[model samples]
Target: MAAEAQSEGGLVFHPLDQFKIYSLFGENPIQWYTPTNVTLWMALAVFCIVGLFVFGTRGRSVIPTRVQSVAELADGFIYKMVEDVAGCEGVKYFPYIFTVFLFILFSNFLGLIPGSFTPTSHIAVTAILGFGVFICVTVLGFVLNGAHFLGLFWMKDAPLVLRPIIAVIELISYFVRPVSHSIRLAGNIMAGHAVIKVFAAFAPMILISGIGIVVTPVSVLAITAIYGLEVLVAFIQAYVFTILTCVYLKDALHPAH
Candidate 1:
């Protein structure tokens, strides 16, 4: 009966609430802050990026070590993505795109650690990332294309009768970018983690039941496979975010195209 109850409970899905503010300053307004696991993950993400780049580049060797080779591969991957999406003209923006991708990727992967929180799973983090891309694209659009970029929203070149309708739709889409971008990342990470947690919560139960012993290996294997999948997802999401930024940059450079 206990085994049955445990098995049943294992099927119950519950989300772990990991968000919390860790500090408040009574004496110093500037020091008042929300402490969260998210913040730690973000810090770690930044550290990993800096460490990898520094370590990877330090040797400057003709024949690279495995670590250096891996780093160079990552660098080249982002560079090629920028070139593909934004064109050769887009190479100049590679730095920002690369940083954004690596930060988000590392942060997402870090959350897969047993106790670490995923910053990208928080709306605040995703929103900031999305907003940064939005602002950069908007600013670059005007700077590079001048008044011509206004056509992106105004539909000035549209047929005289269709201009107003087209502009309205374009305007709506423009405003939706940040919200959609942020939500997509947050939703994906949150869902992935939730699923993994659900599976993990089942592992022990399956091990404890006499019947569960039969299923224990299967449950363990499932967890292992899903974890691997989540790792892949981390990279894919980062690539998607970075590539989208490149696409936006291209729009900024040539809105009409």
Candidate 2:
């Protein structure tokens, strides 16, 4: 969800077209070091996160300023989430989880801007993140619990005959985790942006058609509502993703039950 593209049509009606990635420098082919909308937006998101959490609250005053208060609130909230969901040992990884939440949250909010890109809306970005977590937790499980980590897929408490079958199903489900995780976030971000674009297309109709009096207001109102909901969804999805990571971490730390 980066960079704007023009349409051959009189007015570009393609809502999904905003997601395309092109080189920021020139029309040359993309390479490993090539700068694109995705990289720009992701870097911007990181900058925003650091600015808010680090510089914004650097003072740590007795009576906090607005930015300080917000930074503290976010820090405390994610800290509690990690403690509660992943337990004591998980606190060691709080920094990693917290960084993930901030990056996604910042990207989601920044994408709301008129001409900004949303890296979080792309599957390529989200898939890497999801798979990274999956790998971390799986490897952590094996390292921490040794051969006992395989017990996660073993339904020992199940009926004798169904145990083996259940293990296979569990194994498949385990592998599928990253796919669902990546799609859920990317799908939601893309869908919301597309819906907004669709509603926005109607705004120009007011000047083109005489009957736009009714259509324009309806479209504007719908856009406003959806935009507000998208704001909420941005936070909710970030929180959901973070908390689910904590849950998976817990599973890795304690695969016995």
Candidate 3:
């Protein structure tokens, strides 16, 4: 139900909901929805990550080539991020954290490609990821801190009479984490795509009109600039999600803090 906009160059840019892509199946005409495009792109993202890592490290060498060097750089970056955010104890969770980071980063980048759907743009995908982090953080808190983790919701610093009120607010905030986390990523990607589509729709019309020669160059530059910005956004969003996960894990590990 998103609206389409006409840019200065006369291109009609429509904001299509990629999540609506579905499949029909079964007797009685049951609609079995399959996020085919989303699933395929997500799978591709995973494949790319695995392929790069495997191929990059196939032959261990003291003198690394460009690909190997890039792989090592990524590994060190994630390792340091995990260590800094969740501390040395977080090393055990490195695999999960790294996987989540790469998955999101790749998905965001993939969406920028023409005709590719961004799985992360859908609420369902983002919600699932957020829920996974929520569950892990909750379980980790109990496992690491025991019943004392409940203290995170109840402020012992508050006066005894005010403790219940503070606990209620804290509990609400804790439950809202998944909602906020998922929506932030989804909304940002959705907005960026919508904007890019609108700009792209205009480029052709501008080129077709002889008087609009100036508009053609401007539109081209705009598209190029936006593409670069999208790349930056993709990485930032991934880092934000990872760091937030680490922060949640930290709270679980040191509940009193």
Candidate 4:
């Protein structure tokens, strides 16, 4: 904790520092085209998705291998989700929803590794995803339903005096969907990673200092508990995001529903 020791001892925590974006290569200024940790992890996620789903399932058999079985299971799960939430018509966009879920799920799991970046933790990434859903659904609604899409905002069932207020509230909530959607994913992802990092910072203290013995076990236990929870959260967040997307698509496809 002294000026000389810097990060050496006495519970000097730097949890958020783990989320810093930087290039893997060196200490150079990043450019628009610069390949950073985010790009690396995103590409790795994509690679894993393809390798597991594509190559792993290439050999179709009467009795499926473990990898093929997993691929098939995931496919079936999301396929059913789209159909149930967005209806049979929404099944056409299965590939998009599946890819989004896979990428986020993989990004989250990869981040649990000792030295890995989580692309989904960044607002920039999540915002793009959130806004993309917003824009896509909004456009699809307009395209499919034309002016009738505005019925989503109008609350005809409400009393005559309250219908205008309800419409206004619904319109605002609809427009705010992207912001809320993006923050939900990014906040959940960032908070979990930051908690793990905080616990991990304490583990190093025991190796060189007297206070480590007490802190190390606690840190390890906390990390393990949170890590296991994060595993569940990873899938849940992916599922929530995808299911919500399906719901929005349903609204777009059938605004009155």
Candidate 5:
């Protein structure tokens, strides 16, 4: 397939070829327990997290190491975010929120590798994360607030006549949260990576003398810029997902309004 793309004089780019799933070993067929690219990257992400928090910070020294400092900073950051967003009550769930943040953050950054597969770019993975949050918060909301959790759908501040209409809208939006949350992360990461792929594909193809100079340079610049942007985006998307989870947890904890 790659050879075919290069055969013609025209430059053909398969931007999405990066996202295709393949077994780590010989391609027999993917089974329920098959080790694919997605599984490998995700496992790598998990190992990285463990290395940072466990081995990295194993020494409880007064003078911290770089790894320890980073671990401390991340913990403090997410702790503060939860406390601020969900109030003092939300602090209890810090570990869960922090885990989610680290997993997504690590996955996003790891996917930036030259030939790495992004697990978060796939809907199957993100959907699990998204719906997992959805289910947890939904169940927690009902468990904590009981019938008051349903009050989340009803706006008491709105007009008497508009309450029912607003409730319906809120109900729909509430259900749509998982879909939007998962898609938002997957879509942004996938789009950014695909754009970079397109630029990269053009960078090495010197088809014509005159156009190659301009095209190659421009493609290189675009790839560089987009790659840098994607790094920032990786962090931002992780932050966004974590903050949204906190917001949902806040709603679950206090479903009054």
Candidate 6:
């Protein structure tokens, strides 16, 4: 819960409280089996994806419905992205990439709803996604290329003396991919939501104090602007995450420079 303090002006703000996770059940210590807001939102994202692909387009028709059209567009979009970024071999992995895209896309859009939770705003959720992709690509690279997979970090183009230094830097960066990947998504989502919440808090200023007249209108305008930007950011972040995954897959499939 958001901590609140009373003052002479009766104004307060705790924007970060919206991201807190709490069990659906009574107040108790969380466990693996506990159902939290994160679980609810993640499940909702999955259901939305299934609904769009399965039920939304269950009936194949010559003249498609709006939902079917959207479904097709999304499918084609991801397919082309995979093929273009990772090449034809990566097409075989399109389903995995598409699934990740849908989950993140849906979660981001859904989180924009009032009073709803954003699973992507949490590091735990994003870390799982980032690390899962990292692990998958690493294993696939080795399975497909054997010891040659190490080529991903080796810099043969550099001069003999600089090769080892470049390789060491590349090796560290390779391991850091998951950390950077996960934090990028979580940090952006959290920052946007927190900023929105801060503006929302000021929205009530008009009713609380005399200085609120100016604060309220500015806050509302800021909130509106930020909200619009956030809508775009929601899609861009998903696209970035998915495309990066494709890039990683491309590296795995062809580890050679």
What's the TM-score of each model vs. the native? 0.83, 0.92, 0.85, 0.93, 0.95, 0.95
Off by over 4 Å in 6: 1-5
Instruction: For model 2, give the 10-residue run with minimal summed lDDT.
Output: 1-10
Query: Which whole-number lDDT from 0 to 100 does residue 206 have in model 2?
Result: 75
Question: What lDDT does candidate 4 reach at residue 129?
Answer: 95
lDDT by residue (tens digit), candidate 2, 168-250: 99999999999998888999999999999988887766776677799889999999999999999988988988998999999
lDDT of 4 by residue, 1-257 (tens): 33434544556567787788998789899998889998899899989988998899999876999999999999999999999989999999999999889988999888878778899999999999999999999999999999999999887787999888989899999999999998999999899988998888788778777777898898999999999999998888988999999999999999984
C-alpha RMSD values across all candidates: 4.3, 3.4, 3.6, 2.2, 1.8, 1.7
Of candidate 4, the 10-residue stretch with the lowest lDDT total is 1-10
Indicate whether candidate 1 or candidate 6 has the larger TM-score.
6
**What is the lDDT for 181 in model 1?**
87
lDDT of 6 at 102: 92
TM-score of 2: 0.92
List model 1 lDDT by residue over 174-206, tens digit each. Answer: 889888888888888888887777666676766
Each candidate's lDDT (Cα)? 0.80, 0.89, 0.81, 0.89, 0.93, 0.92
Residue 215: error of model 1 in Å?
A: 6.0
> Which ranges of candidate 5 are over 4 A from the true structure?
1-8
Worst 10 residues of 3 by lDDT: 23-32
Model 4: CA > 4 A from native? 1-9, 205-212
Q: How accurate is candidate 5 locally (lDDT)?
A: 0.93
lDDT of 5 by residue, 132-197 (tens): 999999999999999999999888899999999999999999999999999999999999999999
Which 10 successive residues of model 5 have the least lDDT summed?
A: 203-212
- Give the clashing residue pairs of candidate 4, or none: 206-212
